[model samples]
Target: MTNFSGEVAALAAACLWAVASIVYGKLGARIPPLQLNLIKGIIAIAFFVFTILVTGELFPSITILPMCLILLSGVIGISLGDTAFFTTINTLGPRRALLMQTLTSPISAILGLIFLQEKLNTLAGCGILLTILGVAWVVSERTTDIGHISTAEFRRGIVFGLLTAAAGAVGAVLSRSAIANTQISPLWAALLRLSAGILILLVWASFRQQSTFRLSSLRNSKVIAGTLFAAFCGTYLGIWLQQTAIKFTSVGIASTLLQTSPIFVIPFAIWMGEKVSIRAILGVVISIAGIALLFYL
Candidate 1:
């Protein structure tokens, strides 16, 4: 019974991420991706520090090997992957970007097999395939009002999206390996990775001369509230749960479960008064069935 805890946590993390997406979608329009990333990382890290202090868990001893792996995971996964993802969204639009992002599941599965030698049972594999298919189906349904985008931009966006997915897969695998090899708490592991990622992004932004630390938006009460709420739900709690999932389950299963964020977003869309298509509803149903298969079978 307790063994399923990780999967349940992963599913809950997906739901949190889904809700956070609404806030972030608006914020993304107002803030540069790098700046937003840095701000959220800082906020989440603050929360992590406060939690650690309150809990009084002796700071876990960190080993050089796990530290390096976790640092690399942050650099590749959060820094590079998230930058690419934001660029893809800007260039290709969210639907197209998300369609490519769906590749993360299989990429993680293959990497887990090759690197971690993690094999899924027959039912779990089927569930993963079905879940990915369902997500792709829902995400592919785009609105008819897309503005014009150049061919070169489209190509560039696709490339960035693919890189983002690949980076995410590799990052998950590295984090899984780190956690498997170390005694670090998931909260601490998440903090380390996020700190590394934000530092890398800061350095890269400075090197590229694209650094713009905009604090003007924080003056807006609404923006401040939204940013804080989103950071708490998406970055702080979300990454903690993600680390927890990877610690307890196979990387392949954890990645698959996390990718179900879109399914959770369906209910959010309905709550926001967005028209839900029948196809989207059917896709959600299929995805739910797939999730059940992963657990019950």
Candidate 2:
């Protein structure tokens, strides 16, 4: 169990992110993408700080370079990547946006090979490929819920989705480099990343003369609750798990497992009264086979 802890963490993170995405889809209707990113960052930062304090984990002494890498990872991944993802969600709808996210696995794998010199064995490589294939297949299925999208919107979504995938890949590799051989706790890493991301987001919001703290849409209790829940699950815990995955596993494996959120979303969709097709079911089976290979191989 301990040997595969990273893989497990990555899978768990995907599940939490799946839940968060569902809540975030509703919240996106009421809030702008950047502001939504900022709001969740603030909420998650509070949780990170509280957890660090309660655990009595003092900030570890680290050299400047790794610290800088982590901070940059936060800005790129959380600030830019998340904003692009939210925009993708709005423009393309959650299904297609998630399909776009499937690109992250291969992108991160290539980045890992080039920058980090990390390589996976043949079987592990096959597992990653199968997992990505399943996720892509599942998310590409059309549903009645998705309304009509114009050509311009579709094109815009594709661009942002690609951007999101690139940013996420870069960020993950940077993060993996920072903590792969270090004494940095995943909790602390998550905190630093969230802090840097939120800071940048706040500056960007101010530069645009946008309200930095005005959350009028959150006036509704349900919205507030959902936002808080999503922040806690997705931003706080999910990121910690992600960092843990990067720390313990190869970047390619970690990234591929993280991209399994779409597979996890299947049950959530069913519960929400959305219809699942035979193709989607087949995709899930393939993904599960991939996950099994990853686990037992």
Candidate 3:
């Protein structure tokens, strides 16, 4: 692979996730975010099983260090992070909720420095601001005027989205810490994450008395299909690409590009005739420029 091949991987991951966003939007209308998350985790676990067999990794060979990192990543990112995101997307819509994700890069960068001793620079700092401002500009232009719902609803969505971004940033930083260790295969790490996510979700559901053992995911085909597809493409493959990207490049760059999925999302929205304003496009451009600037610095 080339020096920056991981970037391509990350970008690809973003593209897949952008598609998943639409699915989640549709799914969220009917199912709860927590329930959706649990289903996605189950689907991801299934994909991980296939991936392990195809990659030819000895499952027994995984070390405790890699397992710990993957488990942490799964709980933090998949379980907690995605649950918040689904809620945000349901309440705020994908275009708006994803705008908060542009913060994931800088947030991860700062955390990486504090926790992993990664270098931080001025250009990267400025780039982070510009990117966030750009995304915010597009999504927030209507915040003061949107009359579809009460102010409380908007606040709740934005708050949940922000929380999701924060948790995801922590997950990205943790993944960087783990990848820097270089003792684990990316596929194996991904498998562990999916498995851990399913375990966590199941444990939570059981504690809450929301067992799938009695309920049929088949009864809710659309949500099940959407969540399953989201898991396969977003959780399994997207995370695979991300782990590879983190292993190859600076976490800052990888995260900046990965979170650029909203750029793709805007076009998807427009294609669906959702009446997108020009500000949204502009914001996506600004965030992309910010990503470039961060890489330049």
Best by TM-score: 3
What TM-score number comes out for model 1? 0.82
Q: What ranking of all candidate models by lDDT puts the best one first?
A: 2, 3, 1
For candidate 3, give the lDDT of residue 177: 67
lDDT digits (tens) for residues 1-297 of candidate 2:
259999999999989988888888888899889989999999999999899889999998888999999999999999999999999888866655665676666666556677779776677578668866875675555455654766677678878988998898788778887898889999999999889988999889879965655668989999899999999998999999999998888765776688788778878878988776878778866765665554345
TM-scores, in order shown?
0.82, 0.86, 0.88
TM-score pick, better of 1 and 3: 3
Which lDDT tens digits does candidate 1 get at residues 136-161?
Answer: 67655654323366567656766887
Q: Comparing candidate 2 with candidate 3, which one achieves the higher TM-score?
A: 3
* Count of backbone collisions within predicted model 1: 0
Would you list the C-alpha lDDT of every candidate in the order shown? 0.76, 0.82, 0.77
For candidate 1, the 10 contiguous residues with the lowest summed lDDT are: 139-148
- Model 3 RMSD to the real structure? 2.8
Task: State the weakest 10-residue window (summed lDDT) of model 2.
Answer: 288-297
